[model samples]
Target: MASSATTGNPMPPSLSMPPSQFARLQPHAYLRAHLSPPSSDQPSVRANGRATSQFRVTSVNTGSLTHANGSAVVRIGDTTAVCGVRAELLHTSDISSWGVSQAPSKQNPTNTNEAKDSKSEDEDDQGQIQDLNLLVPNLSLSTGCAPGLTPGAPPSALAQSLSHQILSLLHTTNLVRADDLRIWYQPPNFDSEEFHNPGEGMEVDTEQSGGPEREIKAFWVLYIDIMILSMAGNAFDAAWASVLAALRDTKLPNAWWDDDNETILCSDDFAEAHRLTLRGLPIASSFCCFEGDAAAGWRANVIPDAEEQKKKKGSQQKWILADPDGYEEGLTQERACVVVDKENGKTIIVKMEKHGGWNVDSDDLRKLVDVSSQRWDDLKQALEQC
Candidate 1:
């Protein structure tokens, strides 16, 4: 084939873009614009024809940041999140003391905290174990991402909830088990080390309090931050990727106990680290609700725009976009995110976000789970590099 350009790059036949397509070209939203659903009259084709049960091109990059302990960015066909982990020193111990449900005598009866602190241990709290899991997700929308709009300086409400959900999930699930954190919950004594900051090495107590400072004890505090550079279908996958990478890159200062004349018995240094056991490398997948003729039948793989945005009782909105684009998301019928675990071959329903539900039968659910197992493998391969 004759080369269009001297290099691998193809020469542009036409430089102009249509108004509707060009209007949606924010930096982050560009992916959305490209993946937007096809017109009702035209058949839709995603990048490489990824069916509803399939995923698009995915890749993982690591060590993207140096100052942090561990860091990686996972790109699931353009939805990307960069995660960095920094270990600080903290006095952490686990002691379970039963608490009496006592309200501050003057506290408002409707205080939400009272309900939150109280434990129910339900699916909503899935993955959370009594541990110190701190996750911060930074989402900055950029007009620089899309073409015409002025990007907001701060995260929108949707972005805030994402950070809160990830942080809560990381702790509740025991993803980073607290027991593994080394210290048990206890009162800080002069002998115990304080939490280290981002720049500092592991916390170690020097013998400055009294006589010859004999003991050197340290606590490793971890700060995990994930930044969402773009938004597409799968946010959870990117979040998990960031978490895994950050831990792998993390490094702690060396610690040793020394006495007069005795050779060093043991030491923990930057080389040694605690990586998540990774008991199971399960992943989440989603399917946008689609409804074609049950009698006439459409391909189960493709989603169409039913446009079922927030229907009240008795509303007859029937159509929606499967794997909805950003604009069609609000109008989606039903969105189900399923998580599949390699261990024990178990698949759990993580969440459901949609109005009208479809294809809830066991066969469909089981098929989705089966598909997830195969689909999640690529993510696992990417995480392995960390």
Candidate 2:
């Protein structure tokens, strides 16, 4: 007979150990050890050995997808996001009647009398409205990209929240002009139809009407779909960068009304397509704030000489990490996301969002702003080169 430990009913090593011992050896415990700081004297260094303020190497490529009207792939450190734009035509009659009217153009010079007449006509045509939902953006965060996501599951709350943020930034910052999507009715003979019936039917022949102005018949709706191929950190920054690149590469096909087919016809000539009017580039940067422990005098990684000053401290010290990775993000409790636009060499804050349990000092917030401005210049140059 053999001993029980070596018999056919032998158990695995984990099952042979006590429950308490097995619990302590869980994977969570091991991960925490690597992520958290061991002590105040020795701060935890980033896995990639990057400084607190330094960003990971970034790269961008455009026109990667042949099917898409415009496509781009952006990689920031380990995080990667791919964006594609699909342009579709929408007739004005199909849209809701409660849309906002388009603003008059200031590029063309008009006399006082003409301006007043145009304003009067615009007021009379109050039924016409412009669709604000032309640009639809969606983000898909799949399980293959990250560890936490489950396969075949619906979009998580985090993914939905990020999509909203990107859409809000696009609208609030005026990065893309709304007028660029409008498709006006360009008649073959403008002299003949200068003013016969200005605003009569949906398919009015402007050439026969003898009107000096062309009417808007249809417009382009851009669907921006973003996919995260990998998740390292800073998903927002990577997504926004991809959006900028895709929009820059977008070209709208030339469309005209077809009298025989009773539908709009698009020209096959790629060179005749027009480009979107991008007013300015708005770049976003994220920061994670690490709070120090009062009892242990444990300081964040960003603070300099924090260990030396442990002997002379009252309140807890906080450190700010720019472009934090997944490991750092998991340990941090506070975060700030800032979007800035550079206009004529001046930095303008497009939007700012801060959330956490800890209280942030005014001085620290100001420092974050200054850092974001500098990062914007770097990003702008990178985008221009791409």
Candidate 3:
């Protein structure tokens, strides 16, 4: 005791901190401690009581809205999204950019080769859905889902960016077929002799009275509106899952052009309605890379030489978290999302987006893709049930 006193070493009073308090005060340390067990005998787990590679439970329900053509609600963990698809008619005549005539006549016949080449060019130009803005996707995050979000205000940058991402994915995937949206009209064949020699050799305009002409008078424009009722994390995945489910459940009424009324009309019969044919199902999985360093975060404020401590650590640890919650999202800056689809007993990668960190390499990406495939199957099964 005398030697300890001389060395100025004194025993401090016993102290204890609650788990919730510790987590609130030192979130980075809390997560790191949970991920790293004190001994090898103990198993490492996440703060949410999940494994490193485990994903949240997903639920999908369709046809929830009576008025909408299609509707679905999807929940992933705490995140919930509701999607409604409303179809409106858009007349081709109203489109100023569409210069091509819908009906071709015998006298002013269109060149077959030129028409074929034009069709090819249009296909190469990424289809008419983009040109005509047929599919409109609106994602709203201002539903009081999370803190710091004000309702009824203009859309934030995050919401707009997510909306654009959804729209781009819809276009790139070619999920919706154009043929289903067309309202075609077969004009009466006026090529008969009675019509040609009507009223004592009156001049007949072949262009106006085209023979066996089929024209697209109008198109069904689908407006996909998605609302995030509750947001925990991974909002994109939830919103997209809702969209897929809603589109699958959507059934457009049979519509045709009315020549006498000079307008479009839809059948009231439910049997005549048809569902949109979507391409292969694509699912996205997101992962965040948590750098396993406690001192590099808030401790840097107290520890002036945190950089030196990080250097001395000799390569900081990293933990890849799958389907991170809101708390984990704030702790991690690096994120990667992999979109995958399965066809013909094979997994196909649709899209990959990675940013905010470079620790995730090709091998990590391949693993993420595998995870996405599993997620795709899970979502597919859920959608099939609806």
Best by TM-score: 3
Query: Ten residues in a row with the worst lDDT in model 1?
Result: 98-107
The regions of model 2 sitting more than 4 angstroms off are 1-47, 98-131, 186-212, 294-313
Candidate 3 lDDT tens digits, 73-127: 9999999999999999999889986556232442123553444353454363346
Shift of residue 4 alpha carbon in model 3, Å: 27
RMSD (Cα, Å) of model 1: 14.1
- How big is the positional error of residue 87 in model 2, measured in Å on the Cα after superposition? 0.6
Ranking by lDDT: 3, 2, 1
Runs with alpha carbons beyond 4 Å of true place in candidate 3: 1-14, 39-43, 100-125, 192-212, 294-314
Which lDDT value does model 1 have at 180? 38
| Error in Å for residue 142 of model 3 | 3.8
Q: What's model 3's TM-score?
A: 0.82
Q: How displaced is residue 127 in candidate 1, in Å?
A: 11
Residue 285, candidate 1: Cα error in Å is: 1.5
Which candidate number maximizes lDDT? 3
